[model samples]
Target chain A: MAICAKIDTYEQMYLIRAFEERIAELFSRGELFGTTHPCIGQEATAVGVVTTLEPTDVVTSTHRGHGHFLAWTGDVQGLMAEIMGRATGVCAGRGGSQHLYAENFYTNGITGGMGAVGTGMALAEKQRASGNIVCSFIGDGALAQGILHEAMNMASLWDAPILYALENNLYAMSTHVRDTLAGGIVPRAGALAIESATVESDDVFDVIAAAEQAVEYVRENSRPYLLELRTYRFCGHSINDERAYRTREEEDEWQRRDPLARLAGALAETERRAIEGRCRARIERAIAAARNAPVQDLGDIGKGLWKS
Target chain B: MEKLTVGRAIAAGLRKKLADDPTVYLLGEDICDPYGGAFRITRGLSSEFPGRLINAPISEAGVVGVATGMALRGLRPVVEMMFGDFIALAADQLINHAAKFSWMYNGAVSVPLVVRAPMGGRRGYGPTHSQSLERMLLSTPGLRIVAPTPRHDAAALIGAAIDDSNPVVFIEGKLLYAAEQATVSEHYDIAHTHPPYPAAVLNNAAGEQPNVTVVTYGPMLPVVEEAMTAAFNEDEVACEILAPSEIGPLDTALIGESVARTGRLIVAEEGPRSWGWAAEVVARVVERWGDRLVARPVRVAGRDLPLPTARPLEDHVLPGVETVRGAVEKVMLQ
Candidate 1:
């Protein structure tokens, strides 16, 4: 069954927005450790693309990966605990926000390194004839990282079953995509001989339709495809970022097309309110459980360092 | 037993693992047949195991990152860097990604990946091609480093490294690839410490007292052995040699035990002087047995400089038989 068929993506997007908003509040209060890059405005991209994937298909995510993690695993408790540095965290409190791992979901803080890793995983699935594909999520900023290009070339040359889902949020920290990126986005993958497609919208359905096709191309052909999703980040680059790089008007413009509002606009007023109420309650409960969870023992620091 | 060169031995080890385990794979540049490997380590194995051995592009970081991905998917991958110096290009993958995954994921995943690189400067490969850069990788946490000597079965050690659950950087002495294998002789008693990834301990003459314990690894083993023999013949000084196959997660216990008995220590390596493996061995032993030594510990390593292309200049930068002999003689006097 399709993941979208089972759950309301509108609620999921609302949940991600509320969860990230709570995280920002927590960060302001010094409740969370390390730093976080929240995908507040781009929840639709995570929900739309991941819902199109199967449970068996693996995903390699980026530094700003909480949305992807939430959308894929739906383990809010584990993700919350992980962010709070608790022993019950998905990674046992070690990976924090950027580095996370589950059975089929993997993430690292490195911007573009996972591209190669995902390609390799797709190649492995192809070799095993497992009929599973991989979705490697990278931002437009990741184009500066040489490994992504190398990975794309390798994937095309090897005919690996993988989809490079590039979330173009228009900014890499203080710099816009125009300043860092050259030769545009889609053609970059096209130049590597990879099939490409693009979806430009805040609507989750548009992204889902495009993602389904891109994923099908990879699965059916047993080769790589590039899916470029144009989106925006409603939050700053990180918790501490001041947003000095852009104006309030620009933020207001993107906010008008905010995924949550767009999705809610399509729903009845009561339905939107009920979904928001449920998502808020669920997030609050996860936060409480995560906050009460014990910290990992420092004496066993080397516990997972090796497999023994 | 038919004697095999270090290259052939490594190939045999890889072949054994590939045949034994279905998940084991080989990935590198020009590793497939028609070209084999740059060092020919994967020579004829490609034909034997057809689709298992893959030839990758010149992208070092991509290859290693790909190998890490494969390892995460429950596959054992062994990647080869054409030259050890080129490992610098893949440092991000090996150090950041491969080394951090098992711990970062909190044991949810393990990368049983092996990266083999031919190290050491000889035969005028110039500054880039010929370098012992394994020292640069020693500081990486959760990363295992092994430089097997000819005295031990290189094949078995390589096999052990491949079987290891942790990511291992297998440093092959480029000079030792074609050299004839060395055998245990009657004049020495050979025993191993730490099974699986063992270190070879050669105690010359049974039950005899030694004045100094000389610790070395990789190609330096032969030079230290020769120096020990010379010191014994000339001055009747009995010296023990301990060659650890595993460098990081170093078995300092064995070295400390030998230091306790001998009360003298000399560490020799092929890499440059300061912050080299030699210093690490000495510091570890000294930290454990402070002020117990009769004289100051000596480090016999390459000169603190880049290896030049010229033969005389290169020879001067790198340590040889004379360098090892000088260290032994210097400590013997004190």
Candidate 2:
């Protein structure tokens, strides 16, 4: 068992938590305009899975991808600037929030578009002999899309090096997973004869262990595998969504299972305090950087429409 | 110099491109293995380059999506849709994802992807497979549309498309693939003469002052040429035939220059009339020289109905040689 580290992993979780909380505040204050699917309670899954990846490896994220993007790639400044639709944003304001994408991270704003695209990215990686694996992160709701199955089947058949990470956060917008998906999600991958495992989202170390194993399996065999992180969202689907669909008790229960606090508790008392302090300083600096960033002019909308 | 058919020239160009760039690869149905494409354009390719020439399943959307993904990852991918009409299945990936990726990412990502589809309706492939959907793609903003009319243009334009750093839709005419004569050179030495991808003037039949200008491309080129020749012999009317080899950047300047000189213009297309490539051409011409036109700038196109199954009805529905001739006569009279 690989012992969980406090400095790197805990700092990432704190940064994601701080980032999502700041985004929610900015959005509620009307400073940030556009749809943002905050990864508030889902920080552990992104941190655990992304920590297992290197800078060279590629990943395709879903709409609720702030945690994944910030965890694997750049910091909160570029992400917050992106959400504010500024020229300094990672995508230069064209991709606002739902469309936040970066080439280095191999990220796209697509909802379920990553499932198939990740398969292609993995094929490209395999062809280049880059020894890099592609991780495709999708919501449990995306399992029902036909494109996902098509990509999984092809990836398995060709033995492409890919990890299909299903962040089963219990709800797809308003409907529960049990309502939208038939049978269980992990068993679906087994039907395709893919090696799959399910891990609790609250257990950050366990999720990381599963991700590490899956990544190694893909790299060794050049075959696809599935890892389902059983988690729950503490907030509604989007900023505009109300909690009418679920109970406050359900939300409170997930909040108590917050992966950040759980991971922080596992650390030494002095180390935990030091890590939290560093995370706070980083978040404050990022907030200042994003708030002071230059705004994008309306004329700049057509500037980045093509490559010269 | 050797005379090669358009299909042969395309195959030769692809072969040269694959040999030149290790990153370039071909993917499509029947494009590899025991059979090399239905049209045999990719014949003998799988044997020459075993692993590079990939034969994908009969999934148009999957192939296109995969190609887009590959292109995003620094590999130039050429994906073929056996028939142009079947490209509809992959429109989501092509129109929504591949086209918008670069722009959506604020030019951070370039989809160096080529989607090659054999289009046009002379073979009686029926309604499902014979429809020309180039106009639908032309309406898309981020894609470069190229249709090569001549053999040399077919060979040269593909090289340009392969070299382009943007996503391109290379629509090859099924009728011209086996009929048109091309002068192809060896060693992939075709210098890109035109501006990356632009409209080309195959023959300036009218010399300096052409009274009527005929605008057409792809499979409609032969019909336009035959109609113009017949009209010249019968009525002694000299017309200028202009073929816009590339459609997306559209080469509005070339079309505008010709329409401006001729004063009378007739745009012909094998696809439907409404919102077709002809509409874009006419709109650009009208925007530039709408006041100086001899007539309303007549548009000659196929009927607005679904392509018919019967031979006679299909022939009637499609723009024939006489139909283009009639449009030329009408535009000249006005």
Candidate 3:
């Protein structure tokens, strides 16, 4: 069963925020390998959209995908160990944070590359009558990629059951969506004649409501639907990003709409504290388990080497 | 069992897979009825398999990416690129996603995607339409490549490529579609689980010690054979031809054994001279036979220049039998 309840939605958002906070701390302490694009303030968009999906439903993620990935798979320990390059990671340490894949879940670092693949997955699903919808998440910056439009063209033309979720955090690594995007994300899909909907809130429940309608629209219409989520990231694009592009006032303004703070305001203080405590404890256990996980041996690193 | 053109053989292979397996489908630009394919390799198959063949939008990246997605979703999809040069647009999917899925996903999945692109420089289709861009993808580890020649059954090799678990980029020589011939009575089959390099050596004559070994494949196979025939009769130089159907994961060991016997090696290909498959073959030959080599191996390749649309210049660029023969004679003299 998929996560359809309001309290469960809140719990998922809390866990995502806690996971991102811990990941940030690990990055600062030089504990994690490689670079990570933290989805700090964009938890609601990830969790809300993923909540509407069943276990059999497929989702392709982006580089800043920990929130979306963890929300879908709920494998926090595996993800933590993966980013740490441990052998027991989700992808056996092969995929760091950007690249990861499970049975029905795929998260890659490529911006617009997975768009058509997700569309193709939906095509297969529809052809096989599997009734499993596919959702591929891309950043607002990926709007510039030509492959997305090409994929959306075919997905719409063929009426494939897939949802293209655009997590508009307003910044494609310091470049604001308004400054970089020509018209807007929705209009581009609209021009392609693909049915699309937009949600302009960071509230977890609000996103869930919008996602449910969009997911249903795709399933019934048997066509690709674009869901544009209006959210903001509290932190920089990557760990090293100082975010000099946006001013302190703007950052503070967006932080006011933080999903975590909003969820807390929506719930009673004691209830909020209890959920937050459980989320924090869950993240702590995940981190401890990940730190203790065995790492891939350096000597046997080329386990899948085919050609000499 | 019927004799068929290289193009028809490829179409036959696609037809067999589409008819035999419900999971097999096609994605390409202008691949539907009336258009078939730019090279007409997929000619006359869409009507037989209605709705299975898709005339894709002019999106190389989209076509390849979608096929890769289908492959990952447990369906085999054959993607056709109208021209091999256009594959440059699909490099992201071919090099990164399709090729890296199996290994980067830590052996959890294998992409059974076959991308068939018509490659070569004989046609005067200018710089964009003509050029063997397979050189760019030869370094990608997890991808398999098959270039069918006149000697091998094109349908069987293509079928083998389709059955492969990993991604396979099938390179059909654009010029060889009409110029070369393949016997249909011959059936080529290989296991999808483990497909090694399909390397074959054709002797110029039986019971003769070859003075030189000519390593080439695909479109150059028939051309190299013609050159060896000339070199054998006129120059009195016996030559051996080693053609490997699989481009990446090439069986250099086969080439090494042949070269160790012949002592001289020459690699001929339609791609440009620099950083092409021929150069890689030469490097491997030298690596396998360091000081035992009698002469520095020669590589017969297209001149290091962008292919032009002019017929004379195009012919001047792509390696011909005369050029290969000249190289073979030069290597023998050394």
Give lDDT per model, in order. 0.89, 0.81, 0.84
Give the fraction of native contacts in model 3: 0.67
Off by over 4 Å in 1: A1-7
Per-residue lDDT for B243 in model 2?
74
The residue-by-residue lDDT of candidate 2 on B1-334, one tens digit each, is 5557788888988998988999999988889967889888999988998788888877787778778888889899999889999889888888878888888787778888999999989788899989999887887888888888762457667888888878889888898888755433221112223565645454434344667777888888778877877787788766666777777766677667777777888899999888788888888899988877878788999999888878899999999998988887788777
Candidates ranked, most accurate by lDDT first = 1, 3, 2
What's the lDDT for residue B85 in model 1?
A: 94
TM-score of each: 0.98, 0.94, 0.95
Docking class of 3: medium
TM-score-sorted candidate list, best first:
1, 3, 2
Error of 1 at A110 (Å): 0.8
Identify the candidate with maximal TM-score: 1
Q: What are the candidates' C-alpha RMSDs?
A: 1.7, 3.4, 3.1
lDDT of 1 at B325: 84
Q: After superposition, how far is residue B25 of candidate 2 from its true place, in Å?
A: 1.2
Fnat values, one per model, are 0.75, 0.59, 0.67
For residues B85-161, what per-residue lDDT tens digits would candidate 1 score against the true structure?
99999999999899999999988888899999899987798899989998888999889999888777888999998
TM (chain A) per model: 0.97, 0.93, 0.94
Considering only N, C-alpha and C atoms within 3 Å, which residue pairs clash in candidate 3? Answer: none
